[model samples]
Target: MTARFHTLGLGAFGLGALALSACASQGGEAPRMAQADEGEIVLMIGLDGLRADFIDLYDAPNLQALAARGVRAEAMIPVMPSVTFVNFYSLATGLYPESHGLVTNAPYDREFDTVFENGVSTQEERWWGGEPIWITAERQGVRSGVMFWVGSETQIDGQHASDWSVYEHEKPYDERVETVLSWFDRPASEQPRFAAVYFDRVDTVAHREGPEHPLVAEAVADVDARVGALVAGLEARGLLERTNIIVVSDHGMTEIDPDNAIALDTIIDFDTVFVPEMEGRGGAGHRPFAMVYGEPDAIDAAYAALDGAHEHMRVWRRGETPEDYHFNHETRGPDLFVLADTGWSLTAPSLWSRGYPPYPGVHGYDNHHPDMAATFVAAGPMFENGVTVPAFENVNVHAVIACGLGIEPAETEADPATVERLTGGRCPAP
Candidate 1:
């Protein structure tokens, strides 16, 4: 509604974005625990690195069935530099990366000197500048659960969710689904009215095997099966009719050829700027993008040095970045953004002097690139049946979930009209 998407592409989305799949079924004011007798529930399931087109390409009947009955975005547009931590937080807070202060993963926050890493950075609430749904839900007198959603492990607003789980990357999919479903088995008062679970195997495996590899397909099926399990478990508990399911992937996957590596050492003036985390993974330079930090004079010189150094990589200065990017935070945003072209790696040659172990998959490209588009689907009493809504930004997800929970969303940049349509006007625009 408020400038929904600057660039709408039929590229990776193909004809599916245009087709209409209509279903006729109606229900009450959806997902509002404030009113329902059985206490309607809302489940937010996050699947990492699942391309918007993967469901159609691979065998994912369970997700397809849900979409056949509910709302599916043509593709979910992630905020700029479309990486994991940034977009997931954007989805949770309804803010761009700049507004949320998580411009990129593992940056040197000038004020705090903290690099946003999974283990070290997640504990500090200062790194995150917005209110996540669980915290907002709790404040509004509703119980919420989080099974390892980003920022869930930390005390966002002075407390954890009513129920929460620590992250275990190798945890089995069925176990995670069971963990989410198990929350419902609690007594009516103890159960979470809203909940979230994250799965990363697809993104992990794809990073190694690329999007087309059979292993990625296997991962997709594994996630699809978990969706089936969650649905069945809810039905067995007679909560299926009351639960609204919203599924999303942080960002899509794109394959990077080993030869596509763009060595920053060749272009960047090392004295002028340095990457914050140069010790981990042997300093691979954060793959596909790097946030460079330096003094003003140094940043100016470094920007001049790297300008037009390569055709494959693009350099965006703090103030001169594209409007759609919404980049440029004082502390979290870098002096310069060195973004590799889609399917290329932004790395320093020194780290891989030994050998380049191929990582066929990567993201964090330009947000509007079709390959970077993520997936979105919602099926429940609160959503319209059988529809493919126009593509919208993931930021709107925060408000939509808040609306389903019947709570006022925190201050965010989500377009009210976008959230209204996605939630079938359960929380309409003022």
Candidate 2:
């Protein structure tokens, strides 16, 4: 029977038609789609700003059940300066922030000497340049699906996923789960070989009320219900055994003390700095931190002032950045990167001058902080059941997914140890 594809919109854009055409032109011998022999379907659900400890605070039947049955990591180390856009790209491209070129939510473009706000509209060119796993899967005729991933809205390699949804504001969790189940309902020949679903409300609300807030717990439970629905859908359709399910998050969040705010105007002149967008509440990237842009001489002066003025902060030039951060070297980030010490945050005068209200929660800190450590859980044939692997880079997820679908990874930055474990230590380096 010929395969059929469909999309169920939840007040957002769909990519079914675009993906189908893109998949057809990428000509290569189609890899064998995983059949029931695969023993499980691969479902990767991303919960934004989900700290690993949030799991213990909330009663997540679905996630807890997965952990009880399969393996759960003690903590998943995110890429350096663990912001959402950077880590998400890391997850997709399996490359460090520097290698992938998306170093921060608002990166400085050295050539333009300006700040580029890494938003949904600008992600196509400003935020991402490396080959993501979905693009690689499509090249091999392995159908893939995406729902609100960081770079999903953008086209890659002249193609996008065979199924996808644009990033949008929070929607009902049940609707999100239903959309994912619908993709799997398609005939086996047409169903996505790999799929990603994103749940942002947890992160959104958590950022406002802190990870321990009642609202945050409520949001997690809501997400759990959605996971239960998706899992049930897979079982009812007999796709459970043939699918692999992965649950993860970007970075965690921490509460910000208004008293601890570091006014940038206090350290540098406002006119000399260029902030792309700073008044749109959460839309603007500055929070828990700030990016300073200036001429080389001016940058040097500002760096010096910040060094003595703010003892709680650390600053570095883009090229001299720490190897652990792995930031893009090519002039994409600011001339200098500033990280506020814990309990302290950098705030812009524009926020107050423009009459925008303040936010209560923020991320964009060193990935090593416990608050920045995300979570990862996988259950399927590609992963060893009830096995907990050591902490590794989130970038390895892309290679693991590619191996599961039997496709060539687009890059080789994935850790050899992680790759071997994901492929059952059988698939050789590509």
Candidate 3:
């Protein structure tokens, strides 16, 4: 087999130049696996938007086996604005969105004058903050294969991962599994000590059909099959015994009533606010919470209009969001925040002159909501077998992974006791 590498950037792909540089090993060839001293491999498998209860609600033998053999957290508490990119970054860096600088899936950074849309600003390394797990492993002289982690595409601090794939959600799940396996099947010294893989169809299905739909049961089975394949492959390569396999989702899903939409224009007079960035009518990515930006006086007017006008949603000025959310970023934050209750969505009434939006499910509600809780399943030597732990914050995961790799995790916003609980006291660090 040949070393393969391809990077999709700006024009056709939303990836950027730094991403191309990230795969510089692609001089018509892919980045070859690098040397690492540790035999403890960490394989992070991400099943996006898999609700905590869905594990038992759906038939998932593979996930059940993993839990039977490893630690299964009661639930994984997500950060404020419990959305994909925010909690994913929090899981990767052991920091809250405020510390990681990606307060939202798509944040507007005033300092760089850049807006962080998925395909647009994702490749801009300047927008990323703190040390992601891949960068952490790389800094410690270990190779990392980031098949498709959320924050893995940039050239941070002048360095990139040992190997990676450009973001492609439509890519088949089998292909994703095969690519990650290729990294592990290598000679022991050349294997990456850390790797991450993602599957989006579960989350996608829930978006279109809602989390309770029977189709989601099928999606659950499909991911279970992927897990089965991963386990089989690792065992075939004789790497399973030494590998630390962890399964986690950034956030979970909640059923949203399509008719239960809170029209932004009706709640807050759109005329008082500017267009474009100002109006995010409770869509999926911008939902349970949507940011509002406008001139100071105009924002004041908008907030007053929204204060008691709606029953299903709550609104707050940017800096004044509930202390629990840690959402107050001076520059990247919007002028005001509007959060919808679970099972409800925010929509742009002006844009909806035609009809209501077609989303049947949504996330991004308060992280404490049971529907917002994610998944955390692990099996390996790094954890005690057949045990269950109470729910903990996602911020503590970075330290746990670092502990498994036997490396010192960088200091961040995580509390030591919280991280210790995630590890079951197996690996301790300050």
Top-lDDT candidate index: 1
- Looking at model 2, residue 392 earns an lDDT score of 69
Best by TM-score: 1
Better of 1 and 2 by lDDT: 1
Q: How does each model score on TM-score?
A: 0.89, 0.85, 0.87
Candidate 3 regions exceeding 4 Å error are 1-38, 274-286, 353-356
lDDT of each: 0.78, 0.69, 0.75
User: With candidate 2 superimposed using the best TM-score fit, by how many Å does residue 109's alpha carbon deviate from the native?
Assistant: 2.4
Arranged by lDDT, best first: 1, 3, 2
Model 1 scores what on Cα lDDT? 0.78
Off by over 4 Å in 1: 1-36, 277-282, 351-356
Error of 1 at 363 (Å): 0.5
174 Cα displacement, candidate 1 (Å): 2.1
In candidate 3, list every pair of residues with a backbone clash.
281-346, 281-347, 282-346
Better of 1 and 2 by TM-score: 1
lDDT of 3 at 222: 97
Candidate numbers, best TM-score first, in rank order: 1, 3, 2
